[model samples]
Target: MNAREVMLTIPVVLAPDDTVAAAVHKASASDLDILPVADATGRFLGAVSKADLVRHAHDPDARVGQLDSADILVCHPDHPLERLDHDPMSSVPHRTVVVVDEHGRLCGMVPWVNWAVDEARTQSGHPRSPMEVRTLSMHLHWRCLDCGYLSARAEGTPVRCPHCGAEQSAFALHTED
Candidate 1:
């Protein structure tokens, strides 16, 4: 499934003209650490974090537009999770990803935990097809001889160590249970 299929719609959203006090109230009522900020037309502006509200505690009346953070990770709804080279959410302070349409309008929001759970499910095989079932039953341990990086896989060693980029030939397998 794509990101849109797993994203949460009807997320807590704040208007640019909203106050930090309003943002704080909304955040406190919801489980989200960050809330999407949009205009009246539904155009995504950025996001407002709880930390942002705390940073401006002295000025609770400050407009969200002036303080909303643009340092957010945005992805198209159709974008596949595997196509992402790295976890862009990790680079942002909010640790959330905004899903926008081609028009840059807000569609949904994906928390990092949700994305990680989906990734893990995909990697571990959700439906557990015949081949995947067999693969999941077997555990193979690998140790990179070059960098001493260790990993466990259901299949053979990878072409390279994800940690040190060492070749497969530089790995030793220990299939001990």
Candidate 2:
């Protein structure tokens, strides 16, 4: 599967200008230790770790924009998870990957589990569908608000609109009574 298929929408995000205190509050709502940072128009900037937020929590005025972003891992939506040419995440402490659209807008976050799955698949020389490769055990049907595309995704987690590349806010669970 491609990065887009395996990536998950990071529900909580920080704007570059957000204060360190505010970032700490936002990060608390998420299960991930690292949070993606995006701009007003949804362009990806970087990420701030939970530890970084805590370290700077004493300085509420400190802007998240000041956080060093040189080590963030970046990849396109269509990038194949099966193989990567340049995986700088090998050295990145967070090791989380940020998936971006063609215009460099934030698409979603790829958990390290995907890489582990790839490793097993490669070792076994077995090819499986995205669902088979995914670690999430549950899924639900969803529809993109920006476009009419509908599909199933891991339950409760958001995802980038595969068809129109709309951000997570534009998606809604679809159910029929």
Candidate 3:
């Protein structure tokens, strides 16, 4: 299957001009790890992730430009999603990859977990099959928006944090492993 077929639609996105704090808030509220950065024309610029934002705690003046990686790893909407891992070093450290159309417009964001699954399936010659790596797991640091609690999880969405009655949307998900 191609990226268009497997890629999840672009979730919440933040503009390049948006402050790091705003990105953090939106990400936290949406329970997402990375926030796609776009231009005024909605062009896919780069990505500002939860990690990048947290790094800002040490420096609030940090702009998206400072934390954003201009080297965006993108795949054509028509390109096979399984091809994402064709190059072992193609992907960046923690930033979610952006999917662009022929015109280079931001179409979607492929999280690392989804990308890993696609890559693994392709490598195993079962691109359309379900996950076979039984021990496959990932860890992430999440911030609870409602109660401002910071916690960690292993691959499942966290809802109804103890400190607050908020739902999953009340937390921001950031991959740490």
Candidate 4:
């Protein structure tokens, strides 16, 4: 299926100017992995996950625009879901995949799954059980050498820099205290 067919149309969004408190308040009322952030003109800026926001909630006055971002999978509405599987470099994305139009305006979101890596498992004759497919994840720290961006994910393997779009080869394991 294409992304459009699997997307959830969300009417609410957070603006970059919104405060961290605002993001936390709004996210508290939603069940999405990453809340969509858009501009006044409706251009997709980035996203803020509830987990990430909660960590930064101490700085209640911080602007959402200034938040550090992790790599998010992005695709056009017409992007075939199966395309992610063919690309071996793709990490198993379990966050929200933002769907944008040609103009980079937010269209909707397709909640990503572990299908990429699961497919690999299937190919290796050890397919994941339904429960195992959604098992607990490890939060890892990854630093992007290209842009010096550091991000942590409790879901899939991080393979790129969220700030600069660097490839997996450009990343190094980072440790956070």
| Top candidate by lDDT | 2
Ranking by TM-score: 3, 2, 4, 1
33-145: candidate 4 lDDT, tens digit per residue: 56788999999999876557767867889999998764567888887665643333335336557889999999998654454434545665764567435432243455554
Q: Can you write out model 1's per-residue Cα lDDT over 1-81, one digit (the tens) per residue?
A: 556867788557889888876765555444455678889889999987655665675677898999848445688888765
* Each model's Cα RMSD: 16.1, 12.2, 4.9, 11.8
| Global lDDT scores for all candidate models | 0.63, 0.66, 0.62, 0.66
TM-score, predicted candidate 2 vs. hidden true structure: 0.62
TM-score of each: 0.60, 0.62, 0.68, 0.62
Pairs that clash in candidate 4: none
Inter-residue clash pairs, candidate 3: none
* TM-score of model 4 (CA atoms): 0.62
Q: Cα deviation in Å at residue 101, candidate 4?
A: 0.2
Model 2 misplaced regions, further than 4 Å: 85-94, 113-177
> Candidate 2 residues 133-154, lDDT tens each?
4333233255554554567655
Task: Score candidate 2 by lDDT.
Answer: 0.66
Local error of candidate 1 at residue 35 (angstroms): 0.8
